[model samples]
Target: MTQPDDIAPYDLAIIGGGVNGAGIARDAAGRGAKVLLLEARDLASGTSSASTKLVHGGLRYLEYYEFGLVREALGEREVLWRIAPHIVRPMRFVLPHDERQRPRWMLRAGLWLYDHIGGRRTLPGADGIRLDRHVAGEALEADYTHGFEYSDGWVDDARLVVLNAVDAHERGAVIRTHCRMTAARRENGLWHIEAGGEAFSARALVNAGGPGANDIDRLAGLVPARGLRRVRGSHIVVPRLFEHEYAYLLQQPDTRIVFAIPYEGDFTLIGTTDADHSGSLEDVHIDARETEYLLAAVNRSFRRDVTRNDIAWTYSGVRALVDDGSGRPEAATRGYELPLSDEADGAPVLSVYGGKITSYRHLAEEAVDALSKRLPALRGGPWTSKTALPGGDFAATEQPAFIAELNARYPFLSPADATRIARAYGTRAEWWLEGAKNWDDLGIDFGAGLTEAEIAYLQEAEWARSAEDVLWRRSKLGLHMSGAERDGVAAFMREGG
Candidate 1:
């Protein structure tokens, strides 16, 4: 193909719209690189949205001696909370003591290391708690009189991914959803890429595909030196088992732990079974065995006898972890490996192997630093850590005040609705909410809190096309809306779009 002067090559082209890819795009673009990010489907439609929804230091990783991974992830918790206070907030977890599991002394030691090892500064330290005397105690079985209380964070996993892409786009990065990469090859010291029936060129490429990283490597005609172990993490949502705010970290019989978290104000989120996956990546769903396993774990720990009938919803996602030949899927390392292909052989391509959402910012920083060596257009150092994602511009402590302000500005909004909008959009909630003096001003109420104005904003700016994108990924309002109400939203999106 002849070179076209009209078409300028992007400094960086990235595959995948998950946390890692979007984070890298944000970092690279802020550092002055012209970046392009391509996603096969909607952003965060893969493993990114399917996470356990935590910005936490994997406290259990201590058992596997993954000190470095835990420490780095711990350090990111505060950073994420600081930048995206709207969506990220502190949560305390109650881990009941099970005599059959690890001994008390070992648990204490692990908690101590977890507190100090990661340079803990903002979050409260872990301490022993009398569950019988606590609000969280009401939901637990009588056998659990004592446990440990520790701090972690909760995140809107899908929103986190979307906000990163939104920030990247605002900073000059091009984000294209439904643009799957069909082929890629290094030619004439540049990467000529084909995706979604379109052609493009970039000085450098990034294979940040989470579960499909290996597939991307094959597409680029490169042999991967390391193997990836794809592990499935499944979660289930049930009716609220506990009324209190505190979450539970239950120890399973198989030496694995399950979390029962307060979700969407009306349900408790649980599970996250670790299973080695070798199935097709499309439409990943919770298996009957995994569902029973999670139910058994929760039923054993909580007072509620949550059977299969109580399951409100279930979701499953596959994680791409570095395969270290571990006997168990959970033992596989969450630490990512970024291998940069030698520029001497061809155009450099950085492939992201494995990482959790907590350390995505750090992972992106490291990825950009390595790629900067190959592409000189990337001129700045790390800025994503201090910078806020899109709507998250206010201080973390000011969120409550922001919500109050929203209520004052839009007195028509219910307190719960105000809080949701504040948390989801932070300061930017005013964008679509502008000039709406009453509920009807926001357009057709599709029930639950979704309105026509919000849907328009989602479509115009957030790349949301279908009703499912609005209902599931962008927000969990699907769980709140009735089937008929959801159909109204769907019909509106179809005809209105």
Candidate 2:
């Protein structure tokens, strides 16, 4: 392990723990670069975790005419699913065609381009569907006559970030959670970093601070040629808006669309309103207008009438979109830019701006490629595309069989519990379930299927420090856990369990 007291300078220091930062850390570490990753808070606590949790090509971007960005993201969809099948699963989206919103021909042309542009394979292509005959149609209002069905993938967004950090650590990267970089400066051709009251040195620094990218750049005494426009996206979870497994892509009177996805087996996840965010990054939540907007959009297509009372949970995140001077917040580009500054007498600093979760791996590959030109120590070519993340060695097609196998091995666990474990940890579940033949062997029950054994594993391996870190980020057990149960978890974590 790379100890804190070791004064040896690292080859790279990453400044955030979001998906991009974690991806970069993993890539850099795998390439044999001595790396240090610092997060101001827990991993994926910011924009990473707050995503709509879809790993798609941004179908809506096609309307914006972002062909290059769409192609890149579309190509990454299957690659990401291949490496992390446990977290990324194939999902089919139902787009109900409302003639008032967009012409049917336009939607058809866009879907055609989306299907063809990315060299798509493995996933089924887009096709028109009759609402009267499809299983997805059962949930919609009777008035809806036709729609489109397309393929995308869903991800455990927070877990993806954690897995990347785990992979990075296994490759000898120093993973520091809750370590905020207070200051950074160049001295003697090296970057001196002061984080969490400790001093460290690196040959290069990465400003992967998602929403704070510009702040980090300014802290490094440089201004980005382009600025970032912060946009807030909010989501609401309601008790199973539809019974079907298929997700909905509803069109609104405004050009923007809303998605209603089946979430956590018992809830429907609806979201994502784009509005100009103008507040402290720490305080992001759905306003009444956004909630109303989302509910209205859902009401337009579904037979169900949902209100605030039906909302089981709500979350919001701010995106650091590159300021392209677009008139609408939704019009901002989802592409990323890695601006590298190399001074004559100082080390280089690369700042990441405007990226989506779907393309994080590619962004990291490009970022490290840029850094390797300055530091010759970074070894190896792109390897992550072919590598399996931590526990994702099995084929995506074998998920059901793997879950059944897990249930057979641990007969004491219920089927749901077994499936959850298999999905979350994949083959890695054995690392914690080893030698445990029954429930008692897993230690004290913390409710919501969370056990002391699992908590210990998360703490020891995934850097989970609190109940929020475990329940909210590492897993979505918070949605299923009660207030008293959650408090017990908090108390247990506080008591050093």
Candidate 3:
């Protein structure tokens, strides 16, 4: 095919609506570039919704000598918190001292490195404590007497992706969910593409498909990256194991770590077991072996032994990790690579592989910088880090005060409801809450305070379509709803409400 002189309208067309893709879309759009984002399903419906929910440095990665990766992730903890305080909050993790695990001095040294290497400022640094006297000790086995405390941050991982897409849209990017890219070919110095049965053209294309990157690369007429591996991580949610808000990082004999964190107010989120995934990537689920392994790990650490019946919900996600050749799935590297391929006469194509949730912002910035060499429309320096995400304009530390204000402003809302709204939507909760007083004003109560007005708003603004999108991705409200209520919500969405 002969090359043409005409240019495409969109400077960048991003495939995948997960964190990485959304982050890139937001960054490029803010830099005054014309952008288009496409997702095969609802936003965050894939690995993004089921993947890691924390915005912290992976402490266990330290043992693997991934110092650079850990430090990079650690530095983003407070930055992400400052930028999205409503959804990202500081969390203190309690690592109880086990005689069978690493020695006390080694633990102390690791904590010291973790604290100072990241340039700690607002959050508290690590310190040793007596579990026997600490509130976090109540649910631990009696043998545990001492523990180490460290600071990290937890995020509504799905919302983080959604907010990025929302910001990207607000900044003049076209975000189209349920649109799958079917084909791509380089022609006339541009990307001539077929997606969702529609033809389009773009100056550059980014394959940020995460775990499904292999399939996406083939569609884009390129070979998949070699030595890539998919690691499946599974987690379970059960009734609260402890009354306190503290989270635990338990060390198993196999050198694996499991987290038991307070979740959704009344549940405890325990997980996860990492193993090589040989199953289908389209549908990831926790197998019996993974579930049993998680249960055993939790049972060994906590005083209360929870069985299968205690499990309220379980989720599994597969993340594409760079194979470290250690043969252990847990040993795979969490670091990422953004390879931009620019031939002598075709539009540039950038593919992302193996990135952690905590460092997505940095990864996106780097990706944009790589593409900027070819696309002159991508102007300006990095700006996504400094600006607050959608609905996150307020100061990070003022969340509690904001919750209090929500209660006062909406006197009809209970304190719990106010807190949930503030955490999910932050300053934007008032978008749907401002009205004639009382819960009825919000419309149909689908249980757990999920209102019809809110569902409509999500569909209109956040690209939510099905009940699963609302219940699972948009909010974890399904965890609190009865079966009948959940079915009712499904019916409503199916009826196109």
How do the residues 207-323 of candidate 1 rate in per-residue lDDT, one tens digit apiece? Answer: 988989999899989898578999999999999998889988888888889998999999999979999889999789889899989989988987879888998899999999999
Tens digit of per-residue lDDT, candidate 2, span 89-205: 999999988878888898898899999999799999999999989999988999788889999999999999999999999999999989988788887888888888788889999
Tell me the whole-model lDDT of each prediction, alpha carbons only.
0.92, 0.92, 0.90
lDDT of 3 by residue, 1-497 (tens): 22233744589999999999999999999999999998988788777888658888899899989999999999899999999999999999999999899999999999999998886789998889999999999899999999999998899999999999999999999999888888889877778778787777889999989888888989988987645788889999999999988899999999888999999999999887888888887789999999999999989988999999999999998888876687788988899988888467478999999999999999999999998889999898998788999889999999999999999999988899899999999988978888739889999988989989999999988999999999999899999999999999999999998
Give the TM-scores of the predictions, in the order they appear.
Answer: 0.99, 0.98, 0.97
Clashes of each: 0, 0, 0
Regions of model 2 farther than 4 Å from truth: 1-6, 343-345
Could you list the CA RMSD of all candidates, in the order they appear? 1.1, 1.9, 2.0
Question: Residue pairs in steric clash, candidate 1?
Answer: none
Worst 10 residues of 2 by lDDT: 1-10
The model with the greatest TM-score is: 1
Query: Lowest summed-lDDT stretch of 10 residues in model 1?
Result: 1-10
Off by over 4 Å in 1: 1-5
